[model samples]
Target: MSTPPGAAGKGRSLSAVSRDRIEQHLKFLVGVRHPVAAPAALQRACSYLEDTLRALGYAVDLHGFFDGGQEYHNVVATRLGTRRPEKRVLVLAHFDTVAGSPGADDNASGVALLLELATMFKEWRPELTLQFVGVNLEENSDRDGHGTGLRGSRALAAFALQQGWEIEAVVVLESVAFAGGSVRQAAPAGVPLQVPPNGDFLAVIGNELAQGVVARFALAADSFDIALPVVPLVVPDNGELLPDTRRSDHAPFWDAGYPAIMLTDTTNFRNPHYHEPSDTLETLNLAFAVRVCQATAAFLLGMAGGEGAAPS
Candidate 1:
């Protein structure tokens, strides 16, 4: 486990997450974002998030990169820790949707939750820096995830290493907020675990290094009164070493030797509209999205050494 020297501080998540705010962010992201095809639209979407984070008093950091000859942008909103500003915990989600889809649950939900957290914790300064990142170019299978596939995340991970920032943990939210009435989630093939018959639970997948954080994440959900059927997956290797687990932005952190975990609703494994045009806001389960934000607040607060005393 290549973890930083800091320990998870005893603290509970403070602040109530507004469902309305979550909804608005989701609408704004999914309704406005365009993928590989529309550069101008994608830039506009990035600007939208950047402006919102700025309004919430977060210093927005843009990491610009090029993919397949097209320049892409990643939006970072940071709330530096008062006690350990040198160490950081990253919360990231790609804002760019795949071409031909609206991407409500695919990722807009992820960014919405990230935005909500940025707002929720804006004033509650923690002991570790919290970076809410809206990454881009994550859906491309061509980037080899550990290297190329994760455009924005790969760059951010490299930048953190170059700057010698002590990364306590990196949490990536993807395909969140799509659960209802006994939904059964299936783990990727060969990763042995009997998924409940109902795919209604949220999944937290981590590498061996992230085992401890994953445990706390489940407990945090319960502590925050978010009754999610949370499933914690700890890959025995550098998750990127395995094909099944290296599925999202979190994969790059593991490749960079940082402890990272992903919170997800398990895209195509459950939702039929995974990358289709039908992946719109109307199909999303907003109530489920709210639970994700609440649970995330709990996990982040504890990780950031904030005021909440979640379970050990």
Candidate 2:
């Protein structure tokens, strides 16, 4: 996991991602977006994501799949690379929310960051193709009879595998907003992992295959002066022993043998409003999300090729 040159510097592209833009995205997306429970809201969210990506000059594609004779969609916006278009990197987040909760921090934060990255790199041609994917039905664990969640991501992973796409990395964002100086943080009970006392940090979890990605994110997180710390955890065997680490879209890419990692805020471990009705936009820390966005931009730019590009 060699660090990209100048990896410990603030992303030059950070100027393109702003706190206001993130809030705008969250304001419209932070709601109960379920396929069955709130289909209209779900569709509206999907349309908004598509339109936003399209406005950013991305050729958005609604990748569709079916489960039990029902159809679902994954919004994919591709940014073709100039140096190596064959190899690709994925920046993805799920948009669907769990029933009864608005899921502001649970996922709207992640989706907001995804859109921000899309805008940041809209005109910058990287070395590796970047795909910003907004997936659906990530939180449908049992409410909709969807067995285990991540159906959208699992389907996309399978589609990528079937197409034989050369995936360089998959960066999944999951609940990346909430952070506080005094907020309590804890790992699952009996996991033996030492968590920070405060939640003012980001967690980068990956499998052995994604150690390099996790290391890059940790370095990027520290590169900026945003009071945000990064905790990098590389689990063995795709986090099979620690199920909490597999609770996002990255898990599907890991299962498909692609190097993948998740950027998160340790959702249920630190956020009391997680999966509750109180998880609204007002409770989110936009500053925290901006920091995450900056670090992620640096990380992705470093991975793509370099930081020197014409302003998008």
Candidate 3:
């Protein structure tokens, strides 16, 4: 793998990945943030995300749409590219959860990292317009998730297309915490690909159009301060053959013919607490989550044309 651009010469420090802040964010977000189940918590989550992005010097936009006669929101923060303003890159995480589950690992972890990344890249001059989006309603109201759960992302994709935006990449973070243990990890049933048995690695899964992005992320992970084990999987036909790969918001972008990838911990495959009330802050590994931020910083730095060093 090629060396990640902007990696430190001798040593890399994860100082930019603030563990305390990530934990704080997670603490505030660890609740049943469903519109119907915990509407207050869900509104609070949206406001917090918007306030955080505004504090980071971003012009935040609340993309609202009506679904089932109820208004839903997607928090979007845009940082225009310095060199190539037309090219765009997005980092997003869904902020809503199932009815009963607090969704700490299901998505609070992902939201915390998304906020941290937005803070880390605030001052960077990347070639691609960096967008940090907090999507809502990713978790379907139905238990089987066969309904209109991805409406937020699908609407955003359609809006991007309407504006004729040139999207370079879309990185979706889903259930990124809960790593490092003796418990064995399992691939989705009947999938032939070989994965490490231990639940110690982050899975970077992409569609055929996102092959290069997946490879670049793997290289970026290698150059970070910590040893972040990554399993890079590229699927054909936009992961139609493996339904498990299409579980998150990135699936909608793929449907819009845009390049997107999902960074996850394999969800139910590794996390026994998936969609359970037990998926709380105490169950997450914050250090592992910090490492994910560091790796993502490296990836964005490389995409910035290797012009300047990443935050310390």
Candidate 4:
């Protein structure tokens, strides 16, 4: 991928991410994060995210919404800014896993990275308030594939809309671990952009309006010592026509006319265990996950205009 202008000078190093804590969160979340068969397990996962954010000194809020006659939850924790409190930047992930699967790489990895971001920025007061969110029902775990995904994000977006929250940008964390040099990555039969032959890369998927956010993340990660490859993919204004691009929580923000991007390892493009039971923690590249988290922290801090933050 071509580096953006002055990308080398952006973002902080990857020193803030703790591999041990990431492993702990991944083990705990992947072990009990199946939201379809067991609702209690899903609740526990949300609780864990809430408590961790709270302990990290963020003001937490629980927003409840219903879908399919069932109540689901979204946790929004704010690392209140000392400067521009009205301006906001969001980082979020779905805590709910697919049915009968552990979802280590499918989602637990993203949630773990969210927590790591919270830990890294606990003491730094940024200009834009960072709303760390844990959304629910992102997976069509009920086996109903017809417009069932992104319920939680839709709800959160609705809340943001009704409240007239001035969201600067949103970073939706998705499947971001697992990598290899295999040539199994494939897009639609005749997609416009090129899908790299190898799966060892993080795809920064976004729409036209989100190109700025995508470039910011790539630049932030580039400043660090990370070796992982990043592929920036910008969808057209009519990206809704593409099924592959709308496969995550970030789509809801795009639908709401808000700029957003998804950080992920192309789901099922290289991972054989998309929603399968074989998606376990052992299969994840924890080091790669850490790099993604580190980059995200830098991106958020830079966007928020935090003190000691790198150039955005």
Which candidate ranks first by TM-score, i.e. highest? 3
Name the lDDT value of residue 77 in candidate 2: 99
The TM-scores, one per candidate, come to 0.89, 0.93, 0.94, 0.91
Estimate every model's Cα lDDT from 0 to 1. 0.79, 0.85, 0.85, 0.81
Judged by whole-model lDDT over C-alpha atoms, candidate 4 comes out at 0.81
**Cα deviation of 8, candidate 4, in Å:** 7.2
Each candidate: RMSD to true structure? 4.5, 2.5, 2.5, 3.8
Clash count of each predicted structure: 14, 0, 1, 0
lDDT per residue (tens digit) for residues 178-205 in model 3: 9886856988875657889899989998
- Looking at model 1, residue 268 earns an lDDT score of 83
What RMSD does model 4 have?
3.8
Better of 1 and 2 by TM-score: 2
Question: Positional deviation of 274 in candidate 1, in angstroms?
Answer: 0.3
> Which 10 residues in a row give candidate 2 its minimum summed lDDT?
1-10
Write the residue-wise lDDT of candidate 4 on 166-248 in tens digits.
88899998998887776367656556777788888889888999988889888777866467688998889726767788888
Show the lowest summed lDDT stretch of 10 residues, model 3. 1-10
Candidate 2 residue lDDT tens string, 252-279: 8999999999999999899999999999
